[model samples]
Target: MISAALTVEQRQRLVRVARGQEDGDLLIRGASVVQPATREVFEADVVIAEGRIAAFGPGYGAARVVGARGAFLAPGFMDGHVHIESSLLTPAGFARAVLPRGTTGIVAEPHELVNVVGAAGLGWMLDAGRSSGLRVWASAPSCVPASEFEQGGAAVGAADIAEMLALPSVLGLAEMMNYPGVLNADPGVWEVLEAGRRAGGFGAARRMDGHASGVGGRDLHAYAAAGLHSDHEATTPEEARERLRAGLWLMVREGSAARNLAALLPVLREGPRRAMLVSDDVSVDELLELGHLDRLLRMCVSGGLHPADAVALVTCNPAEYWGLHDYGLLAPGYHADCVLLKDLAGFEVLETFVGGQEARAGSSTPPLPGGGVDLGAGWSAATFDVPAHWPVMEVRPDQITTGMGAPGSGDTRLVVADRYGRAGPGQTAHSTCWTSGTGLTGGTLGISVLHDAHNAAFLGGTDADIRAAGAALEQLGGGVVVVAGGEVRASLPLPYAGLMTDADPHAAAAAVGQITAAVRALGCVLPYPVTTLSFLGLTVIPALKLTPRGLLDVGAWQMIGGADHN
Candidate 1:
């Protein structure tokens, strides 16, 4: 719960403790230390004072001492890049779930909330992080609406980026999902990038994260030249190598929908210094069933990576990249954020400490603030009507990107409605399309958790089913719903921003599990149906996407009529 930086008085006390002139506050004794800086493992007793590591070695004395029982002690893990909103929990709720799994810190991008409520949402996230018991640093969302193709609750420009950079907790500009804009030298995009560069004078040089999926050759070089520091969308070793060669930090992502770790392992094996592990978007079910960065650590170790190297991927590597100097190390003068593990091979976390305090599950969550979801007037079951001969979007298993399908060739009908009522004058409130590969044979799926813009989306086999599911979601105040034969089968209410719930992590996760189960029972072939469904409305990623505007041909970068007039 203590700040990572030390005060003047705390520094003096730490010096006294290091000099053996004063007793440390606590001592973790008899442990094999995993030093990621040098990739070394050695035995030491870590001494903590003023919530910082004052010293570590034999003969260190403290008022309280706990035996490690020959455990492996490493610096607390950190997620290089993540969207906490993807977990469908409040910041406190997210901390409760990951703290026990050895994640003491993260570099989160609150773009999802910002997309729903604009810059005000960033303030809410910062407040929530202060009480979450996790050291949460943030990158101001650079792409507020993701792109002009989609309509978000608010639009952020250079001025907003400059103001956000002034906040101490906000490290820099978040993932610039609009790589095309950068390549085309859009004045707005350049202005935003310039804002981040200007913010560098505050302290550490401000960083700009990237999201260049399928970008390569000259385009990739142009993206890196725009001063983007890292990219998390690389799905193959070639892509990872290309980004690294372009002088960009490679963020290997393994989230609920995008599992790129195993595929990008070769790049990590060849050169891990410039690479870090990240969970771009993890679901509540995954967070509860599996661990956070700890799961990534185990995956790395099992995939032929040395334990120390794997630990560094989630620790020192990210710290150095994100300019978190006081973190990712268990050395003197650093914050005493440590994790005790039962073994190196399994990377089983026995205990997690943040600023020298043992992090307990569900101890840090506070009451969440309000104002995320706001549905427009006149929304009802009739809002989901789809015209015949509409453009179709094909969903691929285990990928967030989508491809174009033949018009009216799919059974599942897709509808996107603006929840915030922010559409321009003369613009329609909703758009209708079609989709294939959802594997839904006879039910309707409705969710307000649509990516970026967070519009209400409905996919169903029949008009009645779609209407029923849409109505159920509206009644629940925004969440996911499954309906069949005019009856609501299962639903999870996400009252906050229509993206997350303030409920406990376990309860929220249980609801998500139930929703997933219902979707699977409805004949959905995708492993993570809700997560996949949410991205269908995202206008940024690949070939084709849908929004309240209409069907978007992402490659063509233009909105096309969904109905096939031919």
Candidate 2:
């Protein structure tokens, strides 16, 4: 269950405990706390009781005391924007992966799951993160299917938006990917926004996030004027600067696929107040190897930002931006969430305390149990037909392009099927120009990770290989699968709407490593093949994207090739 915030009577009790009138629950001594408000560090003893900070004073007696060994204590880091589904781990699993790395708070956007299972999926996400030590602040998904270019597994309307807005766990409306809808004043989009505005009447924060990539000038100003608060889609210094000037909190994304940290560092100098660091989407392997916000903090410091400023970006700045009033600080009456760091340069988290209690090292948080949503078998494979000259989806490091690779190289075939029966339980195949640039020489890859829609997408050199891979994914209950020589080579089962697995965090990371190795053996030479493949179905990004219905020219917001194609 979600822990409740401190009540008035509880606050009064904490104050009495601070005065040494009663023994507190916990205490930490011999540590230097990073004071973000003043950019100073001072030695102090901290006292905690009833899940909130009691005081910062000398000789505070408690039922239990832990020696800090002179380590630096800083407020726990917060990921400003992330999709729990993108981690390929259930909410509890993702929490286990990041909590030890000093990430105690997550501003999660469950739009990916909502696109597949509707409002029930969003409820699952909130409940999954409820019992974990990490605090989850979910945002109501503003776009259910993400866009009209593709069909969603389930349709959620303005009423659904209003219902989620009234939820205590939902912070505000998630990233409004429908920027064109806003620009054109679409009535449907306005209905969703209006519901969120009315949710403020129920005492929810009235924040609206943004997603406007490569959009600047008056268009950007208009988007901001429409009441969108922040964006994580900025990829360049220029884009970041423009958004910062436009009054958008720039969430500098450093995800597994989209690595924008190096390029967006300059924005920290331009406007540090409004700049926050976010992973946006990170995989299990990335979390284990590079860590969460702690990794971002180290990169920022190495890139010439002061260590304290880096801490503020992940801590105070994000907490303030999201209006999490009780967190991101160690001062009196704040939540007792703190991270003990071994050093500034490495950002090594020696210990992490959530609500005055230290989480055990390397232990997986309890998984939220659930079954896979059965997308009925109403699909036909014959809809996939390839023409000689079709559009190609070329994959590069951390990005994709449509029809941009070298020609006459025997382009790979793409088949998208509405496995969820969104379009009457049928599958459609359309040929896209693809190159061996991604290095898949002799096999097929199938996955239900088609972004936003969570449909079955298969890529292969031959139709037989594609069919084998597709069947393998169906057998595994919807997840990533590789088939070669008409045999299943590797797979990972994402039972939850084809997005997250209920596996333990460590086991899931290990399985992802095996899948990565298997893909590499088949000549798939991309840095993050799964992540890049997931984005292939995302119609929000620029240029071209392939949806379950057909290939879409995102810029024009229409299908490519012909009106009747696919």
Candidate 3:
């Protein structure tokens, strides 16, 4: 409700009365205030002046007044943790959709996109953040390249962390995802952590966040002990409780497929109280389908969590953890960000205000038009072509060695059988891709990633076809490519770190969708999930997998010879 028609004196009077000061510049009469301070609801006239709360009482009088007879006026919902990139909408689009859902602030990490464009990408975000009409605090991603396992766009080193910490809007280091480095006391990781501490020491206590997925027990203890202040990867109730007991602020998360919020409600209902709600990654479809943090609030109510408790989770808990002082609470010296809701269960929004101005005043919002998001293209398809070097002696024998594995591990051994029959990688009584005397996969597969396994092994009935895909993709550093029947089928150029495309998300997403349809056309079948060939080198999941280097016995978390892993 920003009006030049409303004089500064009026806004002043409203603030005075709303804040219990001498006189308000403007006052909103007959409204219910969801007091975060006491976790209770009360009805009163809210007054505002100069974009701040002036006063709030039944006998409120000001230059202007907004009648709020029936609505839940409370601190705007703040997503304690989120990734705008994961939202699949540009920041502007991201805000446009969520603001109407009563999301007033977000604590976000630009790490996902940062790996692709580096500092330039970050600068674009910082500038756009200023105009979003919402409070956005940047967390300098401690792991821009995520892990040394997979490649990414751009790089954020020690110096970059220091620089970001110095920025006013940057609220300390983003989650120090490199928990291994922290546990190992790596100099590079600490260098950045220490720098943020130094720069953010005075104004606000900037913190280094954490992402220890499987880290538990003493290591978890030592991790919390070392200053990895918060975590969001606890997948189970037990995991959440243990971390909380160990003193790590558990940012109990609820993302795409991982929903840990309901199970962890007891933690919120119980204990010494430092819990917050986070939407680590909400796709654009999900934003439209379900909602933003507002969805979280309603879920809490259904899960038997008190409405006031739900409000506290979204409001005060986050501000306290990240040391975000101003925007989370609705009080005298706080940022005037408030959401008018219909009820505790319905959680419908009637209006939203930031700094005492109505940014959104309806049920729905349009897609955000992100500023400065550059889609760097021009990476060619030739990059995904291959075979600079090959072990040509690859005999037409019982088994073949696919050349994608960990750097020091054995290659993918393709086993050929005397008979034209062998079970697939699974359902073989033993999960081996080989049949004792029969042929391996009836078709061919190309070399790509095996995720944490880091093996670039190709799949397919024929070795040559597999080589074609692997060779083509590897030659280009990294990107998704498909070749079949000895011909290039389709490809997407990820010039950034071989992981992400600099192209706008929409364009990149479209290209990816096309590639996926093409891959499906090739008739490849697996009992897993879909990804842009990015999770290839990962070794965490159990069973057979491949990487840039070779095959892996996931049960062992180690590389195995293509012929056999045992």
Report the lDDT tens digits of candidate 3 across residue range 1-566: 11123466655555445545565555656667888668788887776656666556666566666777767788888888887765444566566778888988887787765655565555556665556556777788777655543333356798987777666667778887667778778898778768767776564446778878677888899888777778887867788888888877889787653467887877777733867899876555457657878888888888887788889888888888777666576676565688888888979998888877787423222222212211112111112121223221111211111123233232223321101012233211011232111122333343222222112333333445644554566555445555666666666554333333334444555654555555566553321112312233333322333332233554344555332211
What candidate 3 gets wrong by more than 4 Å, as runs, is: 1-27, 62-64, 202-205, 360-566
lDDT for each residue of candidate 2 in 194-256, tens digit (9 for 90 to 100): 887787776543888898876789999999988889988888888888898888988899998
**What TM-score does structure 3 among the candidates reach?**
0.70
Better of 1 and 2 by TM-score: 1
What C-alpha lDDT, on a 0 to 100 scale, does residue 555 get in candidate 2? 77
User: Which clashing pairs does model 1 show?
Assistant: 372-497, 373-497
Better of 2 and 3 by TM-score: 2
After the best TM-score superposition of candidate 3, give how far the Cα of residue 138 lies from its true spot, in angstroms: 0.7
Ranking by lDDT: 1, 2, 3
- State each model's CA lDDT, in order: 0.83, 0.77, 0.58
Best model per lDDT: 1
The true-versus-predicted C-alpha distance at residue 391 of model 3, in Å, is 23
Better model by lDDT: candidate 1 vs candidate 2: 1
